[model samples]
Target: MDKTQNPNNNEMVIDLVDLAKALWRRAWAIVLVMVIFGGAAFGYARFLVTPLYQASAMMYVNNSSINVGSTQVDLNDLTAAQSLVETYIVILKTRGTLEQVIEEENLPYDYETLSGMIEAGAVNSTEVFEIQVTSADPEEAERIANCVAEILPDRIAEIVEGSSVKIVDYAIVPSQKSSPSISRYTLLGLLLGAVVSCGIIVLLYLFDDQIRDEEYVRQTFDLPLLAAIPDLTGKNSGSSYYYSKKTSGKEATP
Candidate 1:
């Protein structure tokens, strides 16, 4: 048996070189596709999508007795404050708090919509929590965040009866929009475009069964080459050529 006739050796394999050649052949199409997708993403981010601004207010919990002196700090009080911070976070998102915020701010949105835009969480494992609000208007986000900060204390006081919540940092109007990230969108678009373009190129390469080179024909037929016919097309007459077997054992060329 011929060593070359082994099934493993005869199996067709696609390699990096073939992929590179395929991509090179379709470079223009891939570039066009990338440009189209990238432009669309830029347009959407810059013009079509609504920009959103975020504002955050931080508050600290003091879950100690009211009679305790300000100068005296206890470890137990600190631990209690840290534990109660999570409870305050939940209370901040309750319907009552959100309703009050909507009423005081005269917001156009309802409780569910307003709740969706508001985020409250403890800062790590500490006794501090932050209230973040996102909206289309920068001033509105700031106002909502501050409003929540103001009302959250009263709500917490009502719930825990004696806990103190103090605003550590007030919300400020953001100078820049947070949503519709142009750079991120553009990068995603570029990646998506490249993936789609590569997929199309691979599909085209797979479906194209026509023999393109002497090596392909030789591999497919297990035959020895004899001669080559040069394609005299004006565009690629200097580069493009094909191989053919001649009746004589000697090689021939054209």
Candidate 2:
């Protein structure tokens, strides 16, 4: 076979051993890339990202009314209170309630900003609802939540005309941040780095055209028995020669 010709050049055959060897040769580069990306993600999550704290207060809707004659609580009033919990959640974030909270708390923020920070939701199917506030400052978050708790009950009483709202739990300053998960970001960085490194390795392997071993030569040319000439140079120098015989049994060395 001619030295320049290739027999197994169909482009569909894949040799896993060659692929593994190629990746092993560049293992250090892949590891370095992985470390760099993972460290960058950790640093960004730990130092660059702003952490927010959340504070929450719980309020209960009590629509129960006493019968003057019997002095017993009305069942229909209690059921009405349960249904009003959802309506109270909507009113809690309204401009009227939020502006009152901001004014009472002396917050240096507008109604929109205060409203954006406040979250109110009914607790399951019960007549209880929770109000939460998130801010960069823990104390501010707690203060805002508590102020909403204090003002919303009276506001609800005025709006519903005899319905009662009571505070069940007061907001406290949160000790821990609510977001910026370091471990999760680091793991994502690791996976991203590994995928990028593997892609680079694959690209390099596909683009490389140099044949590094005798097996590649034989596979490319579909050649029969042939002697190999080993290059001897530098400190590992030894010997280099080649011999081949023709059909006439005449031996030639070059």
Candidate 3:
């Protein structure tokens, strides 16, 4: 092979055919490891993590004039009201509001943890907003959602003057727990683990210098193989002249 114009260049290219061959050679090991790891992950996810119930409530910016005496609500004023509502949604999950929720609910968790559990966001391109609360206790999740829904407007009003946001829908007692998504996560883990296992196997196989196949021998050295010598074992003494004499105790086999 030339230094630049190599004769073996065509054989060194990587493609699907080469990948398929490598994976086929190592399929059993990949499948076994994927199954073991996938099962372990599924088991741990299903059994180890505590289940949490999520409760959500819908609220919207009322945008109605605080002064009933006013004749009309300005469009610009409504836009500003929506923006303010978004700000209040961010404020809803703050330590102050969360601390109040903790005190009102008598939750076992502290303020910091309770703050972490509350999630709030506005529905895009609309006045509607949602508040989600997660808890190990389903009723408590609902209670927290409803509590925030009921109390948040007043809290906002106290913080910002002339606000008119209201709850359109209250949180209902949730029927489903949200954690331990075993089916989806387990399948994902299996796919990732299998790919990684096969990748490592193929890489190691390619880097290894052991002569495992006729292709390896032919590629490493251009030569013609004519014959292979047989082992001079005593078991073949009847068919071989050298081992026959050793078996007859006349001489030792080479």
Task: Indicate which candidate wins on lDDT.
Answer: 1
Candidate 1 lDDT over residue span 28-145, tens digit each? 9888898889988999899999999999999998775634668877777788888888888889889999999999999998989999999888888788888899999999999999
After the best TM-score superposition of candidate 2, give how far the Cα of residue 206 lies from its true spot, in angstroms.
2.8
Q: Write the per-residue lDDT of candidate 3 for residues 51-79, one digit (tens) a residue.
A: 88999999887665634578776778667
lDDT measured at residue 56 in model 1 versus the true structure, 0 to 100: 95
**Candidate 2 structure quality by residue, lDDT tens digits, 1-61:** 1123333555434567778887898889888988989999999999999999999999998
**For candidate 3, which ten residues in a row score worst on lDDT?**
1-10
lDDT of each: 0.81, 0.78, 0.72
- Residue 94 deviation, candidate 2, in Å? 1.3
Give the lDDT of residue 69 in candidate 3.
71
Off by over 4 Å in 3: 1-19, 65-75, 212-215, 221-254
Which portions of model 1 miss their true places by more than 4 Å?
1-12, 65-76, 223-254
Winning model by TM-score: 1
What's the TM-score of each model vs. the native?
0.80, 0.70, 0.75
Clashing pairs in 1: none
lDDT of 1 at 59: 97
Local error of candidate 3 at 134, Å? Answer: 1.1
